[model samples]
Target: MSRLVEATTAEPANPEPVFLDFSSVQVATASYLRESVLAFRDLVRGRRSTFYPVIANANDDVRDELKELMRLRGDVLMVCTLGPAGDVNMARLIGDLDPKQRMTFDLVHEHGETDAGELMRAYGESEGLKHTTAWNNRLAALAARGLLMEVSQGRAKRYRPLFEDA
Candidate 1:
């Protein structure tokens, strides 16, 4: 007979989280970069939660600068957006990570109306990517993440920002 070992340990408490959204970094100058880094450090050092700073389009120069800043401080996650729009290609990246991820960016826009078929076609033309189905899938994933809003449904589905009213 073997005795089961049961060691008692107290679970760790949750910490406060922080979220930062940056739509564009190309406009941020060197001073802005320094200030932002300081702000991030102050916000994250005493917390035991996640910190996400969204930097869109950070071109080669911006990316290099930020990378250097990030190296000095190990508290931020830099999400580099690739494809037609920044961060919109998250689905494709996810697809690369996990094959099980769904591809759902189908839906077309005509006269301000959205249709599944048309949307897929437009996505292909706009991005010059071969996978319309994958684009649709990625769009759907973006919707799920609150980055997009579905405007219409059925044969056509239109989407806009959740912040449109604002």
Candidate 2:
């Protein structure tokens, strides 16, 4: 642990987000995970928010163990994929988002880019949303969470899934 900390101390002041690509790594034990990753996480502590130490291409067992860690520790670990599509824990991913934000995120994720009007119409029949501003706010909230992106279309806005430039 001390050696790991010593090595980490030499990391660049503004370190790039670490990507733990597990494509080649097939197996791991909980002991090694605790010794390496948990220790690293503790060493870094909280000098950041959002993406860092992202694990990608983790197999089912590894992902499950990481999920267990997250459940117990209550800390989020971002996951990255080589391509755009991948699965993540939607409930964990949507932390603190209200119903509208959740719905907006779902809509955007399901259908690529969605305009406010389209979203409003989709839910309008059920929710009685007559004004456009409410839908805008919902999409904006999702965008703020980095789950969605806002694009300009003439005088309107469209929300799309936040695709990382992997």
Highest lDDT against the true fold, candidate: 2
Least well predicted 10-residue stretch by lDDT in candidate 2: 87-96
Clash count of each predicted structure? 15, 0
Off by over 4 Å in 2: 1-78, 81-96, 163-166
Best by TM-score: 2
What is the C-alpha lDDT profile of model 1 across 1-166, one tens digit per residue? Answer: 0110111122124211122334454455545666763444343332312222234445667656665655564323334344553224332111121322222322221223343455557555665567556655754554443333444345655544322111
Could you give the C-alpha RMSD of every candidate to the true structure, in order shown?
15.2, 8.4
lDDT score of residue 13 within candidate 1? 43
